[model samples]
Target: MEEISILLLFDVLVGLTLVWLAWQTLSSLDLFRAIVLFIAFGLLMALAWVRLNAPDVALAEATIGAGLTGALFLSALAQLSASTKRKDEENKIENS
Candidate 1:
């Protein structure tokens, strides 16, 4: 019974955390921050899958959903920021 209660508690915590991460990802104003939160949510989802006895799914989610997706997001964000900076510099030169 004690072990069961512990598992139940863990489940509740993971559920609440997933909900919180989802909210953070959606409501964040900063795109980079939203991306990070999204990655975190994916990782937490992997953990949830493991707890549910789906280790194979969990592994896939961790690698594809969190790792690959997060890398893509960060790379895209970097490119965007770089382009924006270049545009700003060009505008300043034109004004000058």
Candidate 2:
């Protein structure tokens, strides 16, 4: 009985954290921060899947959902940052 209650409490906490992470990911103004939050949410989801006895889903979420997606987002961000830097350099050259 006590063990069950503790498990229930942990489940509720995990659910709440997932919800909070999702909200933060959506509402954040900084795109990079939002992406990071989204990755964290994915990890949390994987843990939730494990808790629910879905090992396959947990594996998928950890690998494709979190790992691959985070990598893609980071690469895209890098490209955008590089382009912005190039544009700034061009403007500086033109001004000089």
Candidate 3:
């Protein structure tokens, strides 16, 4: 009974953290900060899955949800930054 109560408390805490992370990710003006927060949320979700005894879900979340998805987001962000830089350079060249 005591263990179950503790588990319940932990579950609630995890859920709250997840909610907070989601809110921060959505509301933040900085895209990079939002992406980092989202990645942290994914890792927390994996931990929650492990705690719930779902090893398969934990594994999938860690690899696919967190790892691959975060990589893809970061890559896209990099591409956007690069494109912006290229446009700036082109503008400077035209002006000169």
Candidate 4:
């Protein structure tokens, strides 16, 4: 009975944390911060899947969901920043 209660508590905590992380990721003002939070959420989701006895799903979530997707987002963000910087420099040159 005690072991079951402890497992229940763990499950509840995991569920609540997942929801909170999702909210934080969506509501974050900074794009980088949001992306980082999304990665964290994905990792936690993988853990949750593992707890639920879904190792294949957990592996997919950790690798493709968090790893690949996060890398792509960061790469896109870097490209956008570089493009904006180039545009700003061009604008400055035009103004001068």
Candidate 5:
């Protein structure tokens, strides 16, 4: 009974965390923040899979869904930031 209650509490927290992370990922104005939230969402999803006794699925999610995707997002963000900086410099040069 105690074990069941603890599992139930863990389940509820995981659900809430998934919802919150999804909402934050959708609603964030900052691109970097949204990517971070998305990565967190993926990790929470992996945890949910682990709770369901699917370690293989959880491993896939952790590696492919979160790790690789987060790395991709970060890579894109760097390129975007660099381009934006270049554009801003061009604008400044034009104004001067």
Candidate 6:
């Protein structure tokens, strides 16, 4: 009975943490911060899957959901920044 109660507490904590991280990710204004929080959320989601005895799903969530997706988001952000910088430089040159 004590072991069961401990497990229940752990489950509730993980679930609540997942919800909070998801909310933080969504409500974040900065794109980079949002993506970082999203990655953290994915990692916690993987932990929740592991606790649920779904190792395969946990692995997928950690790799694809957090790793690959975060990398893609960061790369896209870099490209966007570069493009915006180039456009700004072009505009400045034109104005000059």
Q: lDDT tens digits, residues 57-85, model 1?
A: 99999999999999999999999999999
Q: Say which prediction, candidate 2 or candidate 6, comes out ahead on TM-score.
A: 6
Q: Report the lDDT tens digits of candidate 3 across residue range 1-96.
A: 999999899999999999999999999999899889989999999999998899999999989988899999999999999999999999999999
| Number of clashing residue pairs, candidate 1 | 0
Clashing pairs in model 2?
none
Best lDDT among the predictions, by candidate number: 1
Using Cα atoms with residue i matched to residue i, what is each candidate's TM-score against the true structure?
Answer: 0.94, 0.90, 0.87, 0.94, 0.93, 0.91
TM-score of 5: 0.93
Ranked by TM-score, the better of candidates 2 and 5 is 5
Full candidate order by TM-score, most accurate first: 1, 4, 5, 6, 2, 3
For each candidate, the alpha-carbon lDDT, in order, equals 0.98, 0.97, 0.94, 0.97, 0.96, 0.96
Candidate 5 achieves a global lDDT of 0.96
Off by over 4 Å in 2: none
| Lowest summed lDDT window (length 10), candidate 5 | 33-42
Worst 10 residues of 4 by lDDT: 7-16
**C-alpha positional error of residue 39 in candidate 3 after TM-score superposition, expressed in Å:** 0.9
Worst 10 residues of 6 by lDDT: 22-31
List candidate 6 stretches off by more than 4 Å. Answer: none
In model 1, the runs with Cα more than 4 Å from the true position are: none
lDDT of 6 by residue, 1-96 (tens): 999999999999999999999999999989999999999999999999999999999999999999999999999999998999999999999999
> What does candidate 6 score in Cα RMSD to the true structure?
1.2
TM-score of 6: 0.91
Which pairs in model 6 have colliding backbones? none
